[model samples]
Target: MSGANIERREIFRAIGELAYVVAKSDRGLTPAERQVFFQIAQEELDYDSWAAQSRFELLDEVIQPSIDRAYNDALHELRKYSAYLTEDIKEKVMTVLQRVAVCCEGLSANETFVLDRVRKDLQSLG
Candidate 1:
């Protein structure tokens, strides 16, 4: 693939990691949260939906990272692709994350905390 396509896919993969982090923050990803994650991935990621799903599956079913590790890894990828994370993209990401957070049992304190940190981190990216 072209370098631009590779970078774009990596960016979406990071978005998936962020979704997994939020969904697993409270007490692991519930069925509802997983559904919301996939739906939001399809809606928000659009052309890059497959990249996001691939990363999410890797984390959820294989790697199963800790919250801190997941968040850090996602942040790393976002930073690597900061040029593409325009305000509109950032807003879409936050929207999906918040949606996933409250989809099941409502947003937990942990989810809120992670969301806040994610917001701050993304804001600081550019």
Candidate 2:
């Protein structure tokens, strides 16, 4: 793949992993949260919801084996890609994460904690 395409894949995986973390944070992904997840993917990432969800499921498969380990790994990957994120993309990322944070029945502590860290990380990005 070309460098740009490779970067796109990496960023998608990183962000998709993040969305997974939020969705699964409380041990279940509710229908509302799922809607927000795919909404972001479709609008911001130009992906159909179902297709984006397939990729996200694939990522979760790779990461869900060890939740704690997966979280640290996702955080590292998120930070790594922050520098390459553009202003528009950063806005969308934050928006998507925020939507994920609050889209369920209500905001869970876990989701809030994750969102706080990610918000700070995105803010520091170039």
Candidate 3:
């Protein structure tokens, strides 16, 4: 892949991983949360783009490897690009993380863990 394509793919995958974590943080993904994830993946990432489509197809074709590659410690990885993403996008991501933390019947242990990590990451960006 071209350098630009690789970069975009990385961004898209990061976004996807964030969405996935948010959706699954509570250990039970809601329909609304799943829809939010799909919308973000389709709209924000422009999944129709050649590069994005290729990455999406690859993800579909090989789910486990793709997920392994996409997963990262968001608190650490996200800090590197804290200045690169728009403020709105960063806020939206944080909001999503917060929402995930509260999405379960109540806040699950995993949700609290991820939420605390996200909170620390956001605080660091400030």
The top-ranked prediction according to TM-score is: 1
Tell me model 3's lDDT, rounded to 2 decimals: 0.52
Best model number under lDDT: 1
Can you write out model 2's per-residue Cα lDDT over 24-98, one digit (the tens) per residue? 777666666766787777776675244446656775555354545545665676567666667776666677677
Worst 10 residues of 1 by lDDT: 28-37
Q: Which stretches of candidate 3 lie over 4 Å from their true place?
A: 1-12, 28-33, 39-61, 65-77, 101-106
Put the candidates in lDDT order, highest first.
1, 2, 3
The residue pairs that clash in candidate 3, if any, are none
lDDT agreement with native, every candidate: 0.88, 0.67, 0.52
lDDT of 3 at 18: 56
TM-score comparison, 1 vs 2, better candidate:
1
Local accuracy of candidate 3 as per-residue lDDT tens digits, 1-126: 776545445544455565556556554457666554454455444542333334433443455232224445443455655555556656655665565455446667876676676566667776
Better of 1 and 2 by lDDT: 1
Which is better, 1 or 3, measured by lDDT? Answer: 1
The regions of model 2 sitting more than 4 angstroms off are 47-52, 61-63
Per-candidate TM equals 0.94, 0.75, 0.52
